[model samples]
Target: MKSRDFTKTGPVAMVAHACVLVVVVCLLGAAVSHAATDEADSPLTVYVAVGVLDVDEISSADQRFTINYFAQFRWVDSRLAHDGPGTIRRDITDITAPRFLILNQQKVWSSLLNVVDITPEGEAVFRQRLWGDFSQPLRLHDFPFDKHTFELPMVSFGGLEQQVIMAPDPQRSSLIADNLSVADWRILGYQTEVREIPLTNDVSVQGFVFSFEAERIFTHYVVKYIIPLFLIVMMSWVVFWIDPTEAGSQLSVAVTATLTLIAYHIALAGKLPDIPYLTRMDLFLFCSTLLVFVALVEVVLTSRLARSDRVELARQYDFYSRMVFPAAYLAAAAWALL
Candidate 1:
């Protein structure tokens, strides 16, 4: 066969050129499409702020709280640009914005005003008021004397941390000075922070955190729980001063104090969650109960001594107990509270 000319002029060569042209065009188109996709998937930065309008209720037993608050979001999207001297209202769907859900939300009430404000330059602002119950772990180890930094974290929906990042907008973030409505805590301070929260071992999402520190307004606990506890503990001490010779009266006092402390412990159990770890109050109560029990044992021993005609020795035991019991209480209180 004559050496076939494979130059472009030949029919076979022309067909081959055409196929090469199509392949090159497909590669170029694919590259352009990939660039577009990359641009679309680039990270979006949203400035976020949260303001607490009121802290309605905090339930220690349930580890949940009800709060009223408003959140504001700001972002810029060129797709939303329009000619306007001032901000104009637009439907929320018209704007490209990050959507998020409170990670700990138990129940929620929405304001239902699904609208966003847009400026001529496409700066968008979205605000919403929310009322809800949110759950959080409360560290009650200190109990009535405990201070807590309550956290509310919002994580973007359907986006990874790299896709939607949150930055705190300090100018718009604040806690209300009044109307906190929480009776047992004094607000220390509040702040907003950007955090990354893991959803799985390999996945995490950006989060906006609004947190406030509050200290227990422990005066209520002191007056309502501690003072009564002190009185009950003091009542147990009465037997130490009682004449050991009157074994009957001494037994009566000790037995009554023991029973009352037991009843009080049962009543107080309803006030807080039955956590496995002991709280400061629990420790103090335990020490008080132990002291009462010791007094009960002493009463029996002294009564036996008095009956056995060791009356002088029984008085000596009473004398020592009167001094020892109060000292023991003070030491126990310091260890538990401080």
Candidate 2:
């Protein structure tokens, strides 16, 4: 039976099928676009307020004061965006960015500025946000979020420059700053200002402002630890004055000088971040210790020669000790200054 041939009606059926497919595609496209628009227009608003207060005395002898500042972040709007897998909402469950907050904390040298502390008070500010999530373990190269302590030098005036990442998650929010760069969702800008917050007790605030950038922190290290340590090492090389024949006295002086340098290294290491490579301070300390050790070795060698048959050699050694050591040390100091 030429059954009512469906093949003869193929063109009409094909046209109807195509029309239905098009309508479904159009509806799906509209839904996705509407959802995207809603998310894009939604505003994720966070409010941050800061209060500065005194913490405690850093040191009695130095007349140094430690101050603490509290920062509070409140999540004002969670409906600003829709959450999806691998989205910003998922990434920043704690609302705090992985980057550091730059603060003004240096009080010693005018040209040096950096962060001083990242307290629980500050972390609490970030924790209050519903999006806060910092469950990942911090790697070595990861930015540190803790109290940054600084021993101010004798000087009193300094300024701090801090650059904080307002929004680092690209899929989340926009940042507002004139000199800022935005990529993906990271914002980079600098905050440069002179801060002078007076303590309640009239003690000078020994700490500078805090910030997220590393350059500001390392600048202080260069000026306070590296420069001063270099000078001290050069000064220690002056021990070459005692005669090699007075080997016992020379050894005593050298050992004492070396011990002093070791003490300095210990103090410096306690303050500075632990790193494997030689810092500027480390270089200076090592050089100073080596010079003292060399002087001790020379004294021992010259004394042994004098006990044997080389008294003249011992005398010559004393001559070099007077001239060569002083000259070399002076030259090194000059080079370092340059």
Best by TM-score: 1
Off-target runs (Cα >4 Å) in candidate 2 are 1-241, 330-338
Native-to-model Cα distance after best TM-score fit, residue 313 in candidate 1, in Å: 1.9
Q: Write the per-residue lDDT of candidate 2 for residues 55-122, one digit (tens) a residue.
A: 22322113223434343333323232333332232223333232223222334112212222223223
CA lDDT, every prediction? 0.84, 0.43
RMSD of each: 6.5, 17.8
For candidate 1, the per-residue lDDT at 120 reads: 93
Q: Write the per-residue lDDT of candidate 1 for residues 3-73, one digit (tens) a residue.
A: 86666377877888899999999999999998867857787778888888899888888888889988888
**Number of colliding residue pairs in model 1:** 0
lDDT of 2 at 61: 19
Note the residue pairs that clash in candidate 1: none
Stretches off by above 4 angstroms in model 1 are 1-35, 82-96, 159-162, 170-173, 200-202
Per-prediction tally of clashes: 0, 27
TM-score of 1: 0.83
CA shift at 184, candidate 2, in angstroms? 36
